[model samples]
Target: MSSRSVIIDNTDAQVQYSPGWQANGSPNEYKRTTSNTETQGASFTLKFVGTSVAVYGTLDIVTLPNTTYVLDGGNPFPFSGQPQSQIQYQQVFYTSPSLPYGEHTLVGSCVDGGGRVILDYFVVEIPLEIPTNTSLSTPTSAVPTTLGSKPTPPTTAIVGGVLGGLLFLMTILVAYLWYRQFRDPGRRRDTKPSFTSAEQDAQTRPFNAPAMASSSYITTQHDAETPNHYSETPRHRDVISTVERHKSPHVSLQWNQSQQPPSYSM
Candidate 1:
């Protein structure tokens, strides 16, 4: 689907030069190195892998002569001679015809002994094609499928249940305390003391003692009548007795009684 070119340096090629030929310089330049041979049969050979291959070198018309090139045991083809005084480096010297894509070889020989030839590099063009499936059947091995595990429930529900039970217990305890505070009679303090039946009767009954007349009553009675003939009326004595009882702290009077007054004798 695609094509690309590759450059091979002169150092990568094979050189067979006679003792009379001279070699110089490195492969980084367009004119990597020069080789001069006064002897014929001096040759340069290059082996490469690609669909097409071309040779590159220097051409000097003043001091260089023509050369011959052959491709894969084919017939020799002579390179064109430069008549004018010109010098060129990294020039395409020869290109082979398009051959099948594989390993190929090219060889160059000095046609004239006096000629100078420079070996620089070679350019190879390669065709790239997308690979296709050669087999028709599918693979028999199966790919394993991974199954996901189910998620587990969290512990929050259990913790919440425990907290809810504690809250219910606390609520019941608070309610019980409230009920006890209002309903328990023993917890209340008495503001008034309770009395016994005998104490109540003693407090309610009056002192039963004979009444003593006041000095004013005695004086009034003496002025009214002689001491020996002073007859005390029962109603008058009762009135005096009531007055005296009210004044005395030891006596108790009852106003609800409807009884006959007692008769007094002087």
Candidate 2:
């Protein structure tokens, strides 16, 4: 960076004047040089960090005035009086030589003369802020060696992504299970449809049979052998009666003269 100069007003906290010195509001910049008993032995001090510093002031009473500047509490140097015309208002009263690039204290004091001093401001000169380059051929700490390793990402990000993926998968699994549970009962309740009587008559069997012919033959034989005049009441025959009829195939008839033909009416 470049060097620069800054103007610090007398009202800045860094400027410390002895007690009983005049302090008008901060807007104006004059530390009064003379009060009733403050004309002589009056001192103002300021600390700053820079290459050099210069104190500027206005001369209200420079007639036979005596002042001195002390830097870093070192030997004092007297303020040189200006020739011909008395300097006033924002004039450099004393300036320190180019000093070190660190903090230094500058003190201005009115020694003997009763002349008044008005400290307007102080200027501090800062030197260039360039940094020097340093060589580092060796590492201070050991580093690990891997043949082919990918750069590691942040732990928080990787963890978050994994957790998010797992959560999404869990949500899908729950939804799938819930859907199966909702659908399975309806599937189990499914039943085959019932057929009507008319539909059953329209159906066909796989095997062939002569059921109609057999039933018709049996019916014809029973009708021809039966007489209508015979008692039509239903009868139950005993087993003995069937066996006796099977035993007698013929019956011998003994006819006597007394046995006339029985009269029959048809």
Candidate 3:
């Protein structure tokens, strides 16, 4: 299990004191084992939940105070103040070995009245909220559920189906158009559009809209006449001149009813 460190001051309520234990010196100097004549039967106990615990205190070098600590009601470990050449505050008096990560009780008592043994503070190593192994459980199921989510719709199939339906509709429309064109011959217009003479002349002659030659709807004042082309009349004699008088160089005359007359000289 992972662990964290904690600092516990001597004045904290977590420390339980017996009758003969009293605050000694300034608060920084810590609590000391005391009595009217003897330091025996004086003790302080603490209950903590952690992996291990260590005790700290201030001690006088002249008369080394004898002390011991009992953990979890088990074997006693020495917490005695040792003789030193110089004065020191907040010194480690006792340290416990690695213990089970759970609640444990610790008791500090005076072993002999050599001098006053001070109790300054405690340092504890505690287990984290979760054990390393417990937090590393399997996460396979949750991952797929989160990333894949609900199964994706069959998008490719749906698009293909829509396209297929449109194609079917287009095929039906084409078939209907084909039937209309072939089944009823009247509906089919194979004959080219007929154009009026004026319209034909306008196209072939490249003329801006030509004037109509005649209006069939208009009434005529005189009856229509049919001319004899081979018969000579007064107008024909005037046009021919006397054949005996002269014969000029002729650019032969020619006429056709449906086509334009050729250029001629008389």
What is the alpha-carbon lDDT of model 3 when measured against the actual structure? Answer: 0.59
- Clashing residue pair totals per candidate (backbone < 3 A): 0, 0, 0
Please list the C-alpha lDDT of all candidates, in the order they appear: 0.61, 0.57, 0.59
Error of 1 at 166 (Å): 78
What TM-score does candidate 1 get on C-alpha atoms? Answer: 0.43
Q: Best-fitting candidate, measured by TM-score?
A: 3
lDDT of 1 by residue, 72-100 (tens): 98999888556556666556778888876
Candidate 2 vs candidate 3: the lDDT winner is: 3
RMSD of 2: 23.3
Query: Which number leads on lDDT?
Result: 1
Which ranking of candidates, highest lDDT first? 1, 3, 2
Q: What is the lDDT, from 0 to 100, of the residue 94 in candidate 2?
A: 83
lDDT of 2 by residue, 1-266 (tens): 34566656676677788864675322223333222213787888888766677776655544634688999989999974654364444556788887766778898888864565566666776644623342222111212222122212236767899999999999999999899988775457536665775477557534343223232233234435774622321221123334434544332222233423344579
- Candidate 3 clashes between residue pairs 3 or more apart in a chain or in different chains: none
